[model samples]
Target: MIDKVVEVVSPERALRREAARRTLRVLNSGYGNHGASRTKKSLIGWNHKGGSPDDDITDNLEVLRQRSRDLYMGGPLATGALKTLRTNVVGYGLRVKPQIDADFLGMSDEEADEWERHVEREFQLWAEDCDAGRMLDFYEMQALVFLSMLMSGDVFCTMPMIERPGNPYALKIAVIEADRVCNPPGVTSPNIRGGIEVDQFGAPIAYYIAQKHPLDSKSMQNKWARVPVFGERTGRRNVLHLMEFERPGQRRGVPILAPVIESLKQLTRYSEAELMAAVVSGMFTVFITSKTPETPLGEAVPLEQQVDVTDENSYELGNGAIIALGEGEDVKEVNPARPNTAFDSFVMSMTRQIGAALEIPYEVLVKHFTASYSASRAALLEAWKMFRMRRSWLISKFCKPIYNEFLYEAVARGRINAPGFFDDPIIRAAYSNAEWYGPSQGQIDPLKEVNAAKIRVQEGFSTRAREATELTGSDFEMIVRQRTKEEKMMREGGLLTNASENQEVLGVPGVENEE
Candidate 1:
């Protein structure tokens, strides 16, 4: 029995190893990998197959992005999904809640508090009007970036006003439309790779920004030039190319709607088909003739002139129009009794697929909450997680870098004071340390969720400031300050009880009575 078992297992193991060997061979060839390959096959250096899973995926990205943008801008499901993302993830705007962490710099308590407050105010003012001419603030600029990121694969933000005349901060970020990113004009140098100039390590050294969108009607869209990653005059990072990377060495972002473009197209077709079906189902076809069924004399005139209906003067069945048939052989209504039998079910299924690709819930997409409360809540929570993750990414990638640059400018211009601002990297980091917060995803059941968060804080598992930040995207210190100020004003204005009354009723002078 033991010998027989060995005989069966030995061949199986050999076969498995052989299959793995072939896979490794293909991977090594496709990945352009050399020494990583081994005589004994291994999965460690394996590369993905089909459509060249490589660093040079810019061609695929561009093609998919154009099609994806068309569908998103026009297709119903795509439009709804995008709208849902913007409403839920961005909502009003991702407000900048900067907290200059002087505490991390080991400053005195009083000094830290004052410095943080002062810097916060400075940052806020700067954030209010980021444009050179103040057309849109940083908040509004964020919406454009995210929307373009969804529609196009990536977006570019060039500091065109880094040294503009009359610019206060010596910095101004202009949101370049995503359509402008393209191959550099005229020079086919190998260094210029995939709509961007790159270093030997595949890092983007510069970008080619076009004068006009390729699809724009006014121009043929063939003019572009290489814009440096940093300024020629100052070497400061003048151009910031924002893109979400998936595979290693990818230079540009793949549109978020890329995965579901086909689905959106099909959904649009389905909607049109159902609409046509309903139109066909609405009217009756009338067969008109003379009482004796007047036969065609001989040579047939045009088919339209052959049929002599009394009310042939365009029976346009619209709003209040009615069709009156002549004394005919018969008047038969050819209305389809069943209109779009599979419409509801099909739309639900396809939209669910689309929602999954868009990282939104089907219920959210259609605004249908027929499902159980628990199920609906679960779907919402899952979608909210994706939104929260994306928001964090946005803040980290774009907001943090921009804020750091703004801080440097602020320090340079004597707007904010830092004891060791230009000295040690640690102090510089502490000075630059700030949190960028957006809108929070408030819980479905606020009472229950708030209670849980309260418990978490009381148990020392979390901090009140962190909890407050998560709930409202505002610092707890700032919140408390505002609350204290409001309470003082209200008490002074005779709208609230004194501290004694608050303590007697709520057991805490700082606590407020609920209305």
Candidate 2:
């Protein structure tokens, strides 16, 4: 028991020791217990850093855009995603219907209706000839903008008033691709992010647009123009930037394929590999065995004279050919077992995950709806929800703004009348309000869908207008008018005798049989 010495620890060392112990204990508990545990083999090398949305997007924007375009061009799934969106979201492009506010303009219902019709006609006249290049109409331009945004992450349009021959409206829309908008060389500022200059509150102030696309000519790439957000005198939007924001401060749009890029690429590679394997496996060759070269392998029989032999050791396989083997060489049978038995299941599993990421259901993405009726209908309904959301976004980001500008120009030129549109913001918004229609969600079972729609309308759960629009993408009033005209025509032609008879022929409800 003689000379035991007690060592004293300093307060700083004691505190440090205690803190380390506590940190380890915390790491071994709760979500961090496994997820944040560095001691585990799985998560030992897992490391991630956090950054603002702009930092994450702008830092890798170029690579992201190029890769997305490549995948769209090369990958079938990527192509399907793009085409599906275009077909559902902007099929034949969105047709605009003016919804002017009657109360605000102090006009009766009839007056408002008449005014809206006039506005629509005038708008169409300008819209048909709105393209600056005169190549595409406004509707086709909508498809271009939608596709550009999906492919390039963002698109820019300059609404410059140009007096072109044979075009009544001076407003011409010139579509610009994403590469045209960029940070000018040797111009760096705290306010600029990806050529979009924003104010302190993160609102866009202006954009720097190059005269020519970067890929077009290197010499013209440096020629840039600083276009302000609005006209100086009129305060109208001069540039329309179509992008969907993921984060508040994000100035640039991420491509639609950004989130699923890696998955799509890997899937494409896997598909190509599988396809190559299947093709290779389909050769069905039968190799001959020989014990001695002198024994002589059977002569390479030509199926016809069309077969060309390039190698002595190899011969072309025929429909039903017998071959003899040389002595002392045994045939070693090989089976690649390609066209992998698990290929379809594995691909579908991966596709489901990718479709989920892209907000597309597996059935819709692959156009495979072999499931039960309920299941197929559910998938369609889910896909329609996403399509509708994207359609709404298109309306807000691209369609409405351009239409508002066109309407303003039309009003200024005395083509359409809008009272107090310029003086009050509310009135201006009302006059600019519109309903955009696109292709409808097609039916699987028309009879069932029609009956359900009928019941919904009769029960007051939905309106005929809403049902008609949802089922057929047709105006309810227009349908009603057309049906009335057809019935009158049929009556005049003796195809219809009475209302009950007509109802019986058409299978319409609310018809009583005459005794």
Candidate 3:
């Protein structure tokens, strides 16, 4: 009975042990197995029971504990847990709270993993939005500011009263013209059949008008608020203005003008903005605009007052309004014009002085003259001639050395041929005068010059001879020693000492010893 009990108990214990081993293996296979030894070959140990209680499985336990720690400490599992928690706490539409992981023992690895994933998802969404151009960076904001200023049309104007009435739109219009010049593809002017030719001076007339009448709100609005539409069939000068048509409820039509006006406005605005920005940025070292004070144009008649129509008030001047005045106004114009003429005389004198200094022809200076004051052409010519005479006298007296230096440079560069080289009259005349001897007190002697030239040639030849002799001395000495040794050899070999025999050996007749 004791043996039977031992046998039954032994097999039963073995079966139980086998089952426990399999259970442990299954448990150790998954991610959550915390306490199982990873190195264990079989789950059973110490006589086929199960895990030994005395055997330290602390290393395996530590590994499992660490893995669990990682899961809760902001790993994927923790990230998922946080996401689920957020969803449950805040509902679907609520913004998910950012995952917060604290490295504490109380936090589970699953919670940390869920938190990490949640943060990652939020960042990814942000990156996608940025890539899709939904956000503006620093440069974009700057561009928007510039565009707003351009669209506002107030950028180029400085008039505090531009919000009022009766201002001329010339300056703004001219600015548009300049812009057309710069960007011709985008902006162009129309061809008027008999309109005035627009030169560079005329281009800026709009700006002058703006300066004269700053209170014109219509001008300001027209300058700034219009968009231009170009039609292929339509004339380039007559761009369609959006401001011309208005909806029934709208108060004002969009004001548009020639493309030239738009261009001028852009240029003026850009220049003004650059100037202002530079001033604000502390880039300007000098305040130049305030240096010159503007003088007012004296009492001038209004454009309407000068009109010649019998019914002056009743006459409406269309765009082609030119007033013809009686002889009385033309005579009165001469009195105010004298001061202008005197001013022009003073300017001409100054210009002639400057032209003399620069050695430029008076005609060249006259071509550059463009001023409100007018001077007589003959008077200007007379003044310029005197100026040139004075300059010649000054050159002869004070600048003789300078003249000599120029002559020397010309001679050294061989730009002027030596005398008698060519038979051309100009060439002969250039070398004929005593002045051709340059600034020297006396005439140059060709014979003495030739003697000096020969001395230079002889010196150069002697220098070459010395160099050649020094270079060949060692080689010549070596050749003489070799010849001596060969001659001795020939004599020892019982060769004849006659000139003919020696010539045959030395390969030269003169090299044989006559003795």
Candidate 4:
């Protein structure tokens, strides 16, 4: 029996060995151990003494070393392993099983089926490669790859602001990672291991860490300090600092200036901070005007007419005070400013120039300004009253129209079978102030009214039937007699007009009787 068993297994074993040999040869060709000595003394090392060592053990070790080297050298085996590892790791299922076994265990049938499918795929891949050791290596690779993916930015997570009544601009500025925690199922926890506790099932059940934005001193220096000073000038002792805060670098304690410069450049067009910086740097320019002398030396003309102080290039001669920027030698006048009769004419002129550049007409700008405290309070009260009144008015106007239409349609359709439609509180309130009214007593009982109308109609038709009988001509009688005869014949032949034989006969067609 032993001989037979060996004979059967020997060929299969030989085939597996041949396959492994071929795989090892392909791997080694790509990544050979270039520096290792080929001498037997160098190759032989530790040996197990329990039994005769397998001759193929050395070859297997060499193959494993070659595969590891291939991966290190950025070869195909390494790439394949990485790709497979990533897929397996990201695809692995982690779920929170409910504490109740009956509720949770059988509840995840669909999920369990999906997981089984995934495991089957892994098994299929493993089966294709006959080496069990490589299959184990793949599992280890899967775990490492999954950890890396979890650490990456694709996860959704959030951190709390460091400051109370936090700066809106700083809040907007903070960068958030993408692969952080999400409320959705299948996403991994974003917190550090010590911060959040996971259940025995590897599910995050609770968090211990305080939510906080990580702050770096160098990065947040401008935000924390009223002003940041870079270095003092030697002579004047003037402090200098960068216009904007620096961004934190990946390495702890380092700061990057590029983001600050980019942020400043982006702010230059619209932000007041950028404008203030420009003004302090003396990049801005301004203009001023001077008054002219009353009259020329030998002119008989009136002083006002004859007065000519400067040409349009300097300042237009007038009591008017204009200020503007200097365009080459010419003065380009801006809007005029209020001239206070204090200080030297030149200083006053400069003040007027500055005011002119910034000033806007009160009538034009006052409307754009928000109302101050007292005015705002008055406006708010007025708005509240108006809103309440308008709402009440709308309810009154619209509800009545809807109610009337509904009642009218319901009556016309013979669908309303009960009384008190008008007596409904909603309807009574809506119609309280109406000048014209519907029925003042009460709504008609619809079912009774319908029955009465139906009875009257029947009675009227019966009276008409009697009139027709009294005035019956030979032709009309002949027609009715003929129809009656035909109906009787049909009934006798087992073909009746009525659906069922048990049904009572209705009154004659096109005829009525008073009784």
- Which candidate tops TM-score? 2
| Alpha-carbon shift of residue 513 in model 2 (angstroms) | 16
Candidates sorted on TM-score, descending: 2, 1, 4, 3
Q: Count of backbone clashes for each model?
A: 0, 8, 38, 9
lDDT of 4: 0.31
TM-score per model over all chains: 0.77, 0.85, 0.11, 0.13
Candidate 1 on 1-515: residue-level lDDT in tens?
75456558797766776688788766645334654544325644566344532344665766777788788777877887777777777777775554556467777878877887787788777776678656888877887788788777788887654454444666677887676777765667776755688889877778888877776888864778778888777566867777788887677777888877787898898798788878776755444444554543123334454445454333333334343444433444565654867789988898888887777889888878788878888988888899888888788778877887888889888888887877777777877776666677656677877888888987999998888867776778777788768766776788666556645633344665553
* Model 1 stretches astray by more than 4 angstroms: 1-56, 101-106, 132-134, 162-167, 220-222, 231-235, 279-315, 318-331, 489-501, 504-515
- Indicate the residue-level lDDT of 483 in model 3: 81
Lowest summed-lDDT stretch of 10 residues in model 1? 295-304
lDDT tens digits by residue: candidate 4, 237-352: 11111111122211011111111223323322233443454454442233433233332212133345545634422323223433333333333344322232342353334323
Task: Tell me each candidate's RMSD, in Å, in order.
Answer: 9.3, 5.4, 45.1, 36.9
lDDT score, candidate 3, position 444:
33
What residue pairs clash in candidate 1, if any at all?
Answer: none
* Candidate 3 local lDDT, residue 327: 31
Query: lDDT (CA) for every model shown?
Result: 0.72, 0.85, 0.33, 0.31
The 10-residue segment of model 4 with minimum total lDDT is 249-258
Q: TM-score: which is higher, 3 or 4?
A: 4
TM-score, structure 4 vs. true = 0.13
Tell me the tens digit of each residue's lDDT in model 2 across 1-515.
Answer: 11121114365666666688777764666666667675678887777677987789987899999999999999999999998888889988788888887887788999998988888788889889999988999999988999999999999999988998877789989999998898888877978879999998989989999887777744732588999998899788889999988888899999999999999999999999999888878876445566576655665576464366655565555657665654565666656789799999999999999999989999999999999999999999999999999999999988888888888888888888887878889989988888888888978899999999999988999998889888898988778888879877887899877778888765668875342
